[model samples]
Target chain A: MEIEDENNFKLRPMKCELNYLSRSDGSAILAQGETVVLVSVNGPLDIKSTSQSIEKATLEVLFCTKGGKPSVADRFKENIIRQTCETAILGCLYPRTGISLTIQELEDFGGLLTCTVNCACLALLNSGIAMRHMVAAVCCAVSEEGNLVLEPSYTQVQSASALLYFVFDSRERNLVTGFTEGSFSENTYEEALARCRLASDVVFDFYRDIVKQYSDVI
Target chain B: MKISIGDVVLPGDYCEEISQVAEKSKVIIGPGLRKEVDRVYITKPGVLKKRNPGTFWVDSYQKRYVPSRGENVIGVVVQKAGDIFRVEIGGSITAALSYLSFEGATKKNRPEVQVGDVVYAKMLVASKDMEPELVCVDSHGKKGRLGVLSDGFVFKCSLNLIRKILNPNCPLLETLKNEWPFEVAAGMNGRIWIKANSMRETIAVGNAILGAEYLNDEEIRSMCNNIAAILAGHVS
Candidate 1:
């Protein structure tokens, strides 16, 4: 299960564009390989008395698939995204309000959940929403040969033995959320976590570059 | 990129100049600039703008409309509840427009307003705790360009674009006004109501305004001329 070669792990080509939608407060379209996700955020808006919390803003996440209705799996994805984003956002700053995030899946090659999380984070940043710290997620798969593959494509995903998604916060690189799909040995899981955490640096650097590119426009 | 004035700033970034000015006198920090115990920090991702001596604010390209007092907004009449009309100004909550807020209206006579109509009104009271209030008449009881808009096309754009086109220095309106006869009412809420002699002209005006959002002053002028020439059948 020990693959010491660094070349074994590589992320797919990533692209992101902010403010993709005119109606949403903040929006972004993110693509990794063939997987594309569009995310829009609207909030710090008025909340109904029943849903409004006096102490913090209410967070809602919705996931929509391509030309299909949302299913139970989509609901689970939305729940994971909402919980991860809630930890990053400074919800207390917008008390008695609501922050709604809607994610639309345009394409799903592989690692769809990871791409969704990353896209949502960028959309949140574009919205100018206050946050305690930024979050970045990376997905890794363990192939049949025990090779760790970062951001495996659709075909690779089908052949992989196990898959893991890890989300890290910017403050201390702490784990915000982690999801696993298949069983793996303890040593293999630890190795995959370490590799994915290292690969997350690439995502974080990508975020900074995107922000800096837009910051120059003004 | 430049890290100076007119550059995009993010939350938690501090400005030494603002902090220094705060020491000399009481400075009014507008939206996007927050004053903590130590320094002045930016709370939005946009260009930092300064006016004259002490007024500072961020010129961010935002789509959401946050209601503020004394600002004119174009809203739709969504609900006609008994005495108050709930107007959707793209804010968190619908604003209340009382029928009596219209000019020459009394208990016996109610303003002829219906749902789905667009109204150009002024925000009388916009607070965080309560719903906003709108009025179609001025203090002198005059409907001075503030009333229900009729037979015009309404569309929404980014809030910053509305402000950009409305700015006196902007050449978009100046150049377009000469090409054709058109009337435009731009609301601070990112909604614009435009009307022209023909539907083609109206669409042309709309396209020009929307296209001018990303262009500079010189580019905007040229774009206006291009649009005008096309509308005049100079280009196919």
Candidate 2:
């Protein structure tokens, strides 16, 4: 179940499109390798009186699967996305309002959570919502032979011994969110974090390139 | 790709022209453009447009409507609470339309506004913190074209499409109006109320408006003709 590639540290080819949905305030379709996710953002809209926060906008994330009802795993992914995006968005600017992020899983080959996070960020940017800075997410896995693999596919994920996801902000490349599964040494964790942090540069650069492509039309 | 004015821009992308102009004089940065300490950055993915003397804004395709003052909008009366009617204008919150805002209305005689009726009104006070207020009468206390509309089909479209057809340069409405007699009221809230003599004509008008979203002026004219021909059974 091991995938031996010459460039194990490199990410898969990425594609991003903004304003994919006309109804949502902001929308984007993002793909990482075989994984695809559609994210839509609606907000600074009215919040329910009971759930409204007086100081800042309330962030709500809903994750939908390709079919059937959402499971507990989907809810977990929604929480991670909400927490990561909460820091990136300037919610305090729109008080007592609510910002809703909806993620639709198009295809899941692997790295679904990371792809979802990236798609949400792009959709947020497309919505013209004010934010302190942009965020990017990268996922990495450790093979049975202790080799680091970046952007692994579904088969590779099943064989991997340890998996880690890291989210970094554009301003300082600081760690905004991090999640890991499986047991690993502290040294391995730090090494994986550093590797994913470096790999995150590619995602951020992709974001710039996508924006630049559209900016040329102006 | 090289970026320039009128090109689509994204967040974190800055404009040198804006910064250079800001150094000499004050420049008004509108929506989608933000002024930082060092430079002016775009905060949305849309075409950057500039007016003659320094006003710059990004024209992006958006669906959600944000209430702004002095814009005519079509809203549905959702509630009849005391003197003020709560109207849903597709904003974050409902707008308040007072009974006194209508023409020829007094404390003794209330305006005949019922729930679920579509009204074309102008936004008087649209602020972020305060609820937006709507008026059906102008300063001259005349109803003019602002009042409850009856016997029409209302549909929703993107805010961008609404602006597109409302643009003075757009040929969609002009071409369609010549082909058939139809009345239309476009709201800044992305809602349109159109009335024609027949259902088929109503559907034709709606299709023409929706189809013209991504088409050019020439295409829109052709599309309107195609729709008209189809409605008249001229097209095989």
Candidate 3:
């Protein structure tokens, strides 16, 4: 009776706290509908004085998904995150020095991985790690019928004709990173990028809010 | 727009930044732009400038080519012929590694080199008209460092990056010097072979160590951990 009542009530999955780690240099756990991600940032660690350069600090990014194994999908996500972080961190300043950031995704309930990267980047910035820009990410899936869907679920992605992931410096709206159409042609790529740019606007706005909330917490 | 490696006083078709001109020495060869006698010189493209001491890069995009005698290279076994193995070491036509070269194999029963095996050898001889010949012998004509590398991961990379990696004090080399847990041999040909217990860990470490030349250690380590974490499917 209780289960039937819950179903009949149309209750949705619960959302909870993000960035479960308090002392981590920086951390965040994002819940988007059923999808979830936990991210953390650490370092700006000292490079050996002899090895240190007067340039920019280094930048690093990592990604993980719910499955026990990090599939090709996860590797693709990691690279996109890395590119965005590189644009934001300004690595040329630290010359001989080093800096790194790591992100982990605990679950993938839907098309929320890109949002997770955005949240992780925001968390890194919030932690006061030096960065030149604020980065965010968004995804768009084009259906077989040529309809564009912003942030489609895993099932939708499987059914879609193409998928595009874009990472952006939200404040400036610059295209900081992009990866798409595992098997797409040049023409398809151009269309996906345009669609992704439109989808990125919404994700970037979300990043702005996350930053504001994070700064307020600090 | 035209470009060159470091700074462009004169622009042409090229990618990447020009770092600095190299000193002229007998080791410098090949063309585009090279540092010679402490000055930059642009040699005709697709031409082989005499080997000088100065560091140089191929201005064009081409796979590694077979080396002449006295040239060192790293290669991977990609195919097998009755008694010979097809080896690729950043070159166009895969070099031939004959079964008779390695000391123990006889004609009737030859040594087998499977796909994915890494070997560090020298180009003892090559002629434009024939398949390049690979020799596993040392300068003294000994077979001390010659053998089939059974366990390792091979990867393809840019030729320029490969050149940067071979020089002394190079970032990837330095990282490996700092107590690397695996055995790695980076050939001048852009083929990097890494052997370790954990393939995933080895790859993570390899990328970070190699990336160090272009990125800082902190960044590299972060990348390593990031890759490791992702492979482990763990959340930070």
Candidate 4:
């Protein structure tokens, strides 16, 4: 469908809970539509001498799918999530340390990457880790009719000709990471970027509300 | 989006009020707030707070302990190397506690510190680049409330709860102290060491502190009262 205005383009329903886990320093479970990802943050913890750095904290992201060992696809997801979060984290504050994020996929209705990235950011915020800024991810799919679907479902993504995911920082709304699947034209990519960027504000507002809810009394 | 004091804030949010004060004279940007080139951005999510005379900070919740200098902390002695003892202070790195830093300790005289001994100490040097150091004695060579802690129960809580209970206005500790005889040493590292006459009382102290995490001042007082009633109204 053609989305003309900012308000016309909509995101999937999102549900989130902060600090959901007991043991981790900070944890969150975010559900975007039917997809749900639980993320827990643990860090500025000690690191082995071999992997330790003198300038900043080492970040490790572990992405696990439901009821299976991690695979190559999971590793790729880990790399993207790690890179997206590493840019926002202020690692120099605690040098010679490490931060580890464990992301668990509870459900996958659609738009898993977007949901996972957003959930990871929320978990980081709940952990109160010093960050330069926060990031929000959005996904858009180009259907066979050459129309865009914002935050499409699993069936929509399966039937789509092209899929695009973009993560934007909260400060400038600049793109932090972008992942593309299948083939799309230059104009189609530009349109997807614009639409996804507009949809990211919803993700950011969701983050603000969740943080306020947990830190309200404190 | 209301960038005002007592209002919730998020990363990348800037307060014009802080800059207005900074333009006039000087404003101290505390933790969770960073002064960039043009605007002062927030790095943490919480309520924005401004102290009198020009101080700005974000009151946020944190569970992990980031060591700061001159804060009291409870640490467990992990290893006793020749001149220094490694104490895990819940930070990324284990802190170094010199044997000579203890009261009456010298080259020939060493404090009887063993492995896995909990101690109340102050952060001597907590630089991010260097190893954190701890001391059990003050400048006056007195071990005032800073030494090996024995016969007590130690538990970990959120850093926010620790600060809340330690705040002068918080009623959790005030009401609990009046209800029972207990001694508490709260560490900035999110650890609370409590010593009471009985194990039940010690557990009660821990429970009261944990339960007060989400309660306001009035609720904290009532919770303390309720705990007292339960502990006292029941059999020994």
DockQ, per model, reads 0.27, 0.39, 0.01, 0.79
lDDT of each: 0.86, 0.85, 0.56, 0.91
Query: Could you give candidate 4's per-residue lDDT for residues A71-142 as a string of tens digits?
Result: 899999999999999899989888999999999999999899899999999999999899988999999999
> What are the runs in model 2 whose C-alpha is more than 4 Å off?
A1-9, A15-29, A65-73, A126-128, A182-198, A205-218, B1-4, B36-38
TM-score of each: 0.80, 0.87, 0.41, 0.97
The runs of at least 3 residues in candidate 3 whose Cα sits more than 4 Å from the true structure, single-residue gaps closed, are A1-19, A47-54, A67-76, A92-95, A182-191, B1-236
Candidate 3, residue B142: lDDT: 65
On lDDT, the candidate that comes out on top is 4
lDDT of 1 by residue, A59-170 (tens): 9998999977869999899899999999878787676789999999999999899999999989988887766567889998889998788889899899999999999986
Scored against the native two-chain complex, candidate 4 gets a DockQ of 0.79
Docking class of 2: acceptable
Task: Name the candidate that leads on TM-score.
Answer: 4
**Model 4 regions more than 4 Å off:** A1-3, B234-236
By TM-score: ranked, best first: 4, 2, 1, 3
lDDT per residue, candidate 4, B1-236, as tens digits? 33888888998888889989988998999889988898888999998898999999999988999999999999999998889999999999899999999999989988999999999999989899999999999999999889999889999999998888889998888898899899999999999999999998999999999999999888888888889999997634
Best by the DockQ measure: 4
Model 3 chain B TM at 0.63
**Clash pairs, model 4 backbone:** none
lDDT of 3 by residue, B151-226 (tens): 6787765444565566664445554445436777666565677777686668765676456544544555566555
For model 2 chain B, give the 10-residue run with minimal summed lDDT. Answer: B1-10
